[model samples]
Target: MVDQWKAPSAAEPAVGDDKSWKLLEKTLLAGVQEQRRARRWGIFFKVLTFCYLITVLVLFTPLLDMERTAVSGSGYTALIDVRGVIADKEEASADNLVTSLQAAFEDPKVKGVVLRINSPGGSPVQSGYVYDEIRRLRGLHPDTKVYAVISDLGASGAYYIASAADEIYADKASLVGSIGVTAAGFGFVGAMDKLGIQRRAYTSGEHKAFLDPFEPEKPDETKFWQGVLNVTHEQFIASVKQGRGDRLKDKEHPELFSGLVWTGQQALPLGLIDGLGNASSVARDVIGAKELVDFTVQESTFDRFSKKLGASVAQQLAMWMGFQGPTLR
Candidate 1:
C-alpha cells in the first residue's frame, strides 16, 4: 500500500502531500473562525435586541392605563391632572382633558371629577374647547360634581377653564388670575441696519405688512396693532365676566381687568378663586372619596425618546452648520 501511494509528481502538484494536509487544515481553521465571528455577532445582536425591548417596555409602560385594583365598595374619585401649558399638542391638551372628563363621567363608581390644574395657560381656542367640554360633560352627568383644584400657577386660559368648574380651589401661593391677551414681537430695524441687510418685502394690501418688525414701525401701524390687542383683551374680559357672572366683582374692583396675577390667597378676596386647597384634599374632603385614579394620558416613551433624539440631532446639525441661537449658554 505504501509503495502504491507514492508522492505525486511536482507538475501534478500535491494531491495528498504535506501541502494538501496544510491546505485542508487552513480551510477548516478559516471555517471555524468564520463560524466564531458569526456566532459573536449573533450573540451581540440578540443582547442588543433584548436590551432595546427592556428599555422600551420600562419607558412606555408608565404611560398606559395601569390595571386598577378592584374597588369592592361604592363611590370613587377620578383625579384628572392637567399640568404645564394647556396646548392642543401637549399632554395637557383639550383632547386629553376631554377624554379624562368623559372617562370620569362614564364610570359608574366615579362619584365626582377633580381637575388637578397646574398650568400657565396656552392657546385661547384650546382652552375654550376644554372649558366647553367640561360644561357639556357636567350638564350630561348632573350627579357627578366637577371641581377645579389649582396648583402652582393656573392663569390666563387656565383660569378661563377653571371658571367653568363648579368650584375652584388653590394653594395660597398659587398664581390664579391673568384675564388678558397679549401679542409681542421684536423690532429688528436697528439690528438689520447694523448687519447691513435690507429686508425687501412687498405686500398686496397697505396694512398687510402692518407689524413688520424688520422695518421701522410707523405711528399708525403701532396704533393699529394696539387696537388689535385691545380687541383681544376685551374678548378675554367678556369671557371672564360671562363665566363668573354674579361672583365676579368687576365693578367693585377697578383693577379686575388690569392683567395682574394674584396668589390664591389674594385671589379669594378678589373673587378670582373660590378657596385654598390641593387636589388630594379636594378629592378626600370635598369629593368624599379616598381612592383616586389618574386619568391623564402620560407621555409615551417612544414619543419622549423621539423628541429628545430629534432635538439632539437637530442641535448637533445646527452646531456643525455654525448656527447659534440668541442665548448660547
Candidate 2:
C-alpha cells in the first residue's frame, strides 16, 4: 500500500511520462479531427436540406412555371388529374383541384383543359365546390373547352364534377356515374344491450347527440336525417339534369339517377357521358391537341413530412388499441 502511494525516483518514468503524453496528444488530436469531420458533415446536410426545401417551395409556387413557360410549346392540352376520393385533406380535395384547374386554364399555350378523373367519389360539399369552379371558369374562358375523361371509376361526387364540364368522355368499360348522396354508419345500442354494457354521453343541446350510435334511434330524428339526404339527392339530380339538358333522355330511363352506376358505353344513351374515349383520344381527336401538359398540384414535401409525423403518433395509438390499421378495399 505504501509503495502504491510512494513517489517515483528521478530515473523512474512518471505515471504520465513523455510516451504517455504523446499517446494522450494523439487521442486528443484524433478526437478533434473526428469532431471537425462531423461538423463538416452536419454543415453539408444542412445545405442539402436547404436546397431540397427550396426546390419544394419552387414547385408549389409560380416561379417554376414562370421559368418553364418561356420554353413550353404552344397549343398543348392542359391535363389536371382528379384521382382518389374527393374530400377534405385528400389529394383530390376541392382546393387542390380548383388551384390546378385555374393554373391549367390560365396558361396561354394551353388550347383546352382535360380533367382526368378516376375516383370512387366522396364529400358532396367538396365535389360541389369543384363543380361550381368549373362552371365559373367556363364562363370566364368560353373558347377554352373543358373535358372530363374518366378512367376506371368516376362515381357519385366524381360524376358531379364531370356533369359541370363541357363534355364527358370515358372508356367503353369505364364505370361512369353513380348519381346519389348517402350517409351511413353502424348503430351500437342493440349490441351494447346484449353485452350488458352501459354507454354514457353528455350534451348541452338536445340535437347535439341526435345521431349518437350508442343510443336508440329516434324515429323523428331518423325522418329528419333522411329528409336531409333526400334534399341533397334532389340537388344532385337537378345538377345532372341542368348540365345534360336536352341530351338527357331521363324520362325513358328513370332508373339512371336512382343511385345505380352505369358503364361509359351504357351511359352514352342515358347522356351521362358524351362518348366512349380515353384522355389520349380526347386530347388527340376532340381537343385537336396532341401534346399534354399536367397541371396537377402535388402535395408539398413539408405537407407529407408533417402528415407522416401525425400518422406515426396515430399508428402508435391504434396499435395500443389492438387495431391492425386500415386496408384499402
Candidate 3:
C-alpha cells in the first residue's frame, strides 16, 4: 500500500485513496498561494522603495524651477524670503541668502528683488555678510531695486540686513528695531556645586575658556567682554545711521540702543522702516514683481539621514554612559 502511494498515478488514487489525494491537493494550493503572496509583497515593497527614492531625489536636486507668473505690464521681480536665525551653519545662512539674492539680480527676467525678512535676529557676522552682499548686488545691478519687507519680527541682525535694501517696509505690528548686540549664557557653577559634579577641561591659553560657566568669571574678563559688546553696538549704530541717512530722528530716545523693539507704526516716523507693508504687497505694488521665487536649498536624504543617525547615536551613547551633562548653548 505504501509503495502504491509513493508511485502515484494521475488516473486514480491508490492505497490512501481520495483522502490522501485531497491532502496533496490542499498542500499544492497552499504552496501556490504562499508564492503569490510573497510575489505581491515583493512588488508592493519595490513600488514603495521607488517612491521613496523619487522623493529623496526631488528634495535634494533642484528638480523644479521657481514658477514665474506675469505681473502688471512687462517688468519682472523676484521675491526672496529671509526667515529664522541667520547663522553660518543654519539653513538661513548669509552665504545661502547672498547666493539666492545674487542669482535674482543676475537674472535678466528678474527686474528687481523683494527681500521678505522675518527674523528675531542671529549672528552679527552672518548678518554683516548679508548686508555686504546686498550692497555688492546693488552696485552690480544698479537698475534692479532691492526692497526689504519686514514681516512679524525684524530685529537686530535682521534689521542689519534690511538696512542694505533700497526701501524697508514693515507691517503695522512688526518688530522693526533692535539695533544692539548681546552674548548670553548661563552659569552652572551653582548647579555643579549642588550636584557635586566637577568640570574638567584643559586649554592652551588663560582666557581660552573665558565664558565657561563651570569656572568663575574674572572681573577683567567681564570688562573685556563688555568692551567687545560696546564696539559691536557702535558698529551696529553706525551702520543703521549710514543706511537710513538723514531719515532717522535726532531725538536721543533710550530705546535706540537699549535693545528695545518698536512696531512698524512707531518705526515709520522714527525712520526705522520706509513704509508699512508685507513682501507680496510690496512686490506687486512697488517692485511690480508679483511672482515669487524660493532659492533655498532643500536637505538631501544623505544629509538628513546622517544628521539623524549622528544625533541618535550620540543619544544612545549618552544613555549608555549615564551622562546628564547640560548642553552648552
lDDT by candidate, in order shown: 0.79, 0.84, 0.78
Candidate 3: Cα lDDT at 245: 78
Question: What is candidate 3's lDDT per residue for 92-187, written digit by digit as tens?
Answer: 688678777876777777767888888989999899898888888899889988899998999999999999888999999999898889999999
lDDT of 2 at 164: 91
Stretches of candidate 1 above 4 Å error? 1-44, 47-69, 301-329
Can you give the lDDT of residue 105 in candidate 2? 79
Instruction: Please list the residue runs of candidate 3 whose C-alpha ends up more than 4 Å from where it truly belongs after superposition.
Output: 1-40, 51-63, 69-73, 250-254, 293-329
Clashing pairs in 3: none
For model 1, the local distance difference test gives 0.79
lDDT of 2 at 256: 82
250 in model 2: Cα distance from truth in Å?
1.2
- Ordered from best to worst lDDT, the candidate numbers read 2, 1, 3
Model 2 C-alpha lDDT per residue in residues 222-260, reported as the tens digit of each score: 999999999999999898887778888799988888889
